[model samples]
Target: MTAEAETTTGSGTTTTSGRRPGTGGVTARRWAPGTQVLWRYRDNAGGRVHICRPVTVVQDTDELLAVWMAPGTECVKPVLLDGSPVHAEPLATRYTAPRTTARARWTGAGVLKLARPGEPWSVWLFWEPGWLFRSWYVNLEEPRTRWACGVDSEDHFLDISVYPDRSWLWRDEDEFEQAQRSGLMGPEQARRVREAGRAAAEVIRSWGSPFADGWEHWRPDPGWAVPALPADWDRAPARTAP
Candidate 1:
């Protein structure tokens, strides 16, 4: 079977755009429902943001969910994913790779899980933050998608959308009907984020910058909801985790 053979789903990342999906180019594909995926996050400064594990199953409300038996320090909202070909999988993640070493300095956290005993690569980025798997210019990983969020982090806006191809397009989340407008994202920063996703696809793909790698996984602390952004704290949307 090819590496993309398994159709599993867990939490990773996805894109939200009305644009079109691409069909030509070689890039990493997403997992099918029932496959496990683990994820870790870091800021531009390379500091640990937070870690989350989502399942691939679509909820009654059409939301994707993944459950991790975490400690008490973490909170995960049933992440709301937008875009095509979503699925749910049943598998627990195990963060392999050492976390305490000089070389592992830049690598913060990751999940560890077992797959087919002999499966070649145990962990994969089921979903990314910006978009789903597939497409060329838009097929880049979410971590590498450079974004300039709304000023002051208010209004709760996701600057740009990413696709499997890594290509990108400008987006005005505030333009959405249900969107709650916040501060402004400088035009320059917006343009950069919109262009970055597409431009970085191949450059990063060539170096293999993936979402959930064995070396970065870490078991969550416990069950909880993702904290509301302080900027949007006044009007933070209610959270629901699976």
Candidate 2:
């Protein structure tokens, strides 16, 4: 995703202007529903971006930044052949799972992710077009680190799912346990993660922010095209000098 230039202000707001080399200026536009932007996450503060997804803005208000990931959008993700945690493998092969891009599609229309400022996880609402309102998925990941083009974070490998009744379940307990056993997460870290999950559950119980914000009524613009994965999805360094 080459750009003419990017500038970040002291307040942590970033702006990218001009056309991306190959994508033309498809990404240069005002922030509004149907605008396409890359949502990415780095491995560390200055590490290479290992995950990237292009999504359309569903809502971009001060209280919430909601985006939609349409079905079959190309995305970069880490996976182990045996389905082991990426950090569980021996050091020699830990990050050698063969960098690959795959189609990321949900079971239905797509996923609508909602995030608030300084939150540790974003609430993702899933559904089928006509039926509506399936479930809410809280993806527990690092608080987003913003970049000129989009936001970034590392997935914590654990998540919570809240049904319409407000009851919740830990979606990837086995993986979280495995990550802990594999030394990827220490005891204290695990405890904090659990606390974060609890915090999210409380929000669900309260029907907070996006939940009460009426985003479920949101629909993408029919004229908006499916965004293509930037050519640099896997290789770009999110921050050149932090």
Candidate 3:
């Protein structure tokens, strides 16, 4: 999930300016590294969206796609009860309460999200400006379903962050638990989320494809635009294939 700069199209690989292999009228092209793209997630299956960020592409290949969400960028995130942290509120009022957009900047260095085709989760690496690796955040969510404009997935709420030394901790256990209590996620679904976290930790410990990839040294294209929040960002068709 991440856009536009000089690109080339030929053979199996095509630039965003050209059509992808399968889609008829939909233009699909590999966004070059350093290109800015929008990373977003919808709140409901085919309903309104709740999160949006302009991220810099790090790697885009047949195997995996990586993007960086830098700090200080204007981003859209969900807030409950006058900007209170979502986890701090009681479970009963969590979803029933008024939800609003919070204009926020990423506080830390930034986050690098790595997603593979057909995967259920994206392993996000957090760090400071100097590439000081902070931790790997395993965001357990719906497997990303690609669309004409960008990728879409629903946040599963539960997440895990793993340190450089391989130590890991649950980042949003309270929210995950609350969701279950609120009748949002069933026990079976919770188990699946935990399993996904463990799988991501294994990848971290082994220094997998993305961690070993040269993304830390990747830089954004100087001419890349600061992507704007589109008015139709929240809108998507009723069905999308992953």
Query: How many residue pairs clash in each candidate at the backbone level?
Result: 58, 2, 2
| lDDT by residue for model 1 (33-146), tens | 233233323321223432233222111111122222221213222211321111121111111111221111112222222222111111223332223333112121132211
lDDT values for all models: 0.27, 0.68, 0.69
TM-score of candidate 3 versus the correct structure, residues matched by position: 0.77
Residue pairs in collision within model 2: 40-152, 41-153
Residue lDDT tens for model 2, 8-123? 44533444565543335544322456667778766522356766888887765334678888877777765566545465666554544444334444345688888865678998
Show model 3 residue runs off by greater than 4 Å: 1-28, 44-47, 81-83, 217-223, 237-242
Q: Write the per-residue lDDT of candidate 3 for residues 1-242, one digit (tens) a residue.
A: 22334355432223554333345545445656656667788774234678988777767754687877766777888888589876566766776677776767778676778898767788887766677767667788888776545677888887877766667777877777877876777889888888887777677778776667756565555565555666655665443333
Provide the TM-score for each candidate, comma-separated.
Answer: 0.23, 0.72, 0.77
Candidate topping lDDT = 3
Q: Report each candidate's C-alpha RMSD, comma-separated, in the order given.
A: 19.9, 8.7, 5.2
Weakest 10 consecutive residues of candidate 3 by summed lDDT? 5-14
Q: Any idea how many clashes model 1 has?
A: 58
Better structure of 2 and 3 per lDDT:
3
- Rank ordering of all candidates by lDDT, starting from the highest: 3, 2, 1
